[model samples]
Target: MGILEKIGDIEREIARTQKNKATEHHLGLLKAKLAKFRAELLEPKSAGGAKGEGFDVMKSGDARVVMIGFPSVGKSTLLNKVTKTQSEAGAYEFTTLTCIPGKIDYNGAEIQLLDLPGIIEGAAQGKGRGRQVIAVARTADLILMMLDATKSRKQRTLLEAELEAVGLRINTRKPNIYFKIKKGGGISYNKTCNLTHLNERLVAQILQSYKIFNAEILIREDCTVDQFIDVVLGNRKYVKCLYCYNKVDEISLEEVDRLAHEPNTVVVSCEQNLNLDYLIEQIWYHLNLLRVYTKKRGEFPDFSDGLIMRNGATVEHVCHSIHRSLVENFKYALVWGTSTKHDPQRVGLAHTVDTEDVVQIVSK
Candidate 1:
């Protein structure tokens, strides 16, 4: 089911539990969680759920979206441009001190866009705060690695190989228990990072430089680079990266052209504001979300309490999202969107609504 439905279901369950005096106490806490989540969903982009572990809100699917890149690239710049988020977009290295997020309208859907601290050389080996880098990478749905167009192939290649060796993964079941970085130097075969530069550039070279260490944290222990490729390309749900080759203005035309066709990427120059519009459009297209509106009427739903939803969403998702009991005894939703009477066009529990559509659901 979609997040809207899930939220309704949560709300429904919360209501049902509230009826039982004994469970009311526990229900209250749950309600708070869902309410906060609901608010996060309704709030503008960049404002997200409560930090760390437990039931946080989700967009299309569960995976959190993350943006990655070498220090000094335009990761934050892109975040600001796309989400309208004011991420500290500076020209120096390591400007992003922490993970920041911004929300934007993507064809009417909502997705979490996270900006992580830039990865530095030796990140996997505890350089430039490697642990934190992996921590953020672990929580990402899609990873957008920003490669500086001005940097030579060798410069990019070395960092790529190191990241591969570190093994990017996160174990949700454990509280940062399974995270680890692999060690590498010589052309030897190690469990962490294997090196056999025999095959060279096209395939083997990439394998040597792009493979993950032991990604058994969330994925199968046997997962391969092809699987990682799938995850980045949006097969796992979130769009791989709407790739951007930043600093294009500084690089030669040939380099910019090379980056444009390099695997999955788009060209942009933050300095010159080159092709930024196209880049934003690319992000919007990949996300496929539409803009929806929320309104307050008379004494509208206690949205400040954080248990409301957009017009098209059903009572069930909201209820379950609020608390599980509401779902168990969810009578029926009485809603009014676009008008006070009620919308015959308004679908039932599993209906999808659009932006600016006003709705109210009356439920037991």
Candidate 2:
């Protein structure tokens, strides 16, 4: 059978199989197999892989965010509203045939926003440029999953499944597991905390399925079999996602209130311009960016624009961000902010920086 047929068969078997101690191992293996087949399908044949064509757009700004939804679901409208760019919105399906790019400047950070073509059922199966669209999303720092307020909530589930099938884990953190493969040593399993979901033997079996014979596995947290498999696969993308329900003007206040209460969800009406600023604020917060101002030895700090860094960034990270050569030449950084114990404290490269911190690099 073909790859899709094989995947379908495995999926059917997984669905038919009951969930219990007796079936857990079987289900795990089947899920692994299914994931393998899906990967194979998404993998490009040539070394260069599939070209972006119309789907590929150059990434700009401090971070990239993509708008994903079914066609005519107001994704284009929302993009135009937020970024002040024209992205061809209509009342028909597939109004956007390619990726449309825009920018949202908030809090001194320029965020790139992309409006992509509608995703359909079987998108992960390469239906209607879905692979290309998802490829764009893989490069994104954040994914805005736009949904129609009038449509069934199941659409969100379907979109999520499509993204997951292609190795994108939304709003999920990476499993705290360390796995290393050695040539000679046999399987060594170490657990720092009590594992309620997985045991050593089952982990060994899963590792064996991947042809990992001599490896060391460290489990720092209580994770599931699927999470373990993800570590073994080692190519999954852990990204943050915001569920945006558009056309809220068409819905009732009760419905809007209900969706607002959902975690990581925003209710907005692009036509009515409802809650767009709040949405932008949430995006800024979730991006978790830090603005670090650089100062010279004998002059004042540059306050017009600050260097944007990700949260938990260190002084060394700032150095590297400025130039790769600066890391090697770096001596220490003087900081004046909440991250330092005292004002104008001299810190080393390992010192973590906080937002609005003033940094002055002292080179050797």
Candidate 3:
């Protein structure tokens, strides 16, 4: 049978198989096999494996945020409202046939917003050029999953399922599992905590299914078989996803309130221009970006221009952001911000910087 057919068969087998101690190893092995087939299915059709045209937009700005949802979900409307770039907006399906990029300046930082074509059901299965859409989504620092407030709840569910099927774990972290292959020694399995879902024998079975005869496995926490499969495949992306429910004006206040209360969710009406400012705020918040200002030895710091950096950025990062060769002659940095114990404190390259901090590089 073909790869898709094999995947379907394994999925069916896994679904029918009962979950219990008796069939745990079997289930784990089946999951590993399923993961392998899916990985192979995603392999490039050509040998070179280059990206197709129209999806090759250069990444710009301090951070990137991509909008993904069903057709006519107001992605284009939202993009046009926030940024000067005018994406084609319509009330019909598949209005956007390609990825359109726009830049929005917020808090003195330029953020790149992408309006991707609306994806359909079975997107992950290569339907409606979804592989291209998902390919672009993987490059995003954040995912803006737009949903129609008037549509059924399944819209969000289906969109999430497509993203998940392509190995995008939204609002989650990678599993803490250490695995290494060895040449001579046998399997060395160890764990710090009690694993309820996985045991030594099950791990061995799963490894053997992948032809991993001799390897070292360390389980840091109790994780599922699918998580283990993710570790083995090692191509999964863990990104922050904000669920944006648009067309809130078409829904009741109670329904809108319900969606607003959900974790990492925002309610907005693009047509009514409601809650767009708050949406931008949440975008910056989720990005966790910091702005650092630079000062000269005898001059005032330029308040209008600031260097954008991620949270936990060190003085060394600041130096690199200034220039590639700046670090060579770097003596030290005088930091004036909350990250330092005292204002204008002398710090080494290892010192971390806070938002809106004034940094002066003292060179030799």
Considering every candidate listed, which one attains the maximal TM-score?
A: 3
Q: Superpose all Cα atoms of candidate 2 onto the true structure and report the RMSD in Å to 1 decimal.
A: 2.1
Error in Å for residue 279 of model 2: 1.0
Q: Output the better candidate (2/3) by lDDT.
A: 3
TM-score of each: 0.45, 0.93, 0.95
Q: Which digits, one per residue and each the tens of the lDDT, describe model 1 over residues 1-364?
A: 6445665677688767645546644453444344334433433366577743322223433234667777878888877776767999786888988767776544334556777788776665446655566555545555556777777666556655444434342211111112222464322222333322111122222323334332222222333333333332221222244456788888788867767886556788876788877765665544333333333335554433333243445545655555678566655544544432455343445655543444444345
User: How much does candidate 1 score in TM-score?
Assistant: 0.45
Cα lDDT tens digits for candidate 2, 95-129: 89988999999878999999999999898998988
lDDT of each: 0.52, 0.90, 0.91
Ranking 1 against 3 by lDDT, winner: 3
lDDT of 3 by residue, 1-364 (tens): 9988998999899999999988888888888898788777777465775556648789999999999998999999999999999999987889899899999899899999999999999888888879889989999999999999999999989999889888999999999999888996989999999998898888888888888889888999989999988887789999999999999999899999999999999999999999999999999999889899999999999999999999999999999999978789999989898998888799999998999999999998
Query: Candidate 2 or 3, higher TM-score?
Result: 3
**CA RMSD for every model?**
20.3, 2.1, 1.7
**Stretches of model 3 off by over 4 angstroms after superposition:** 45-54
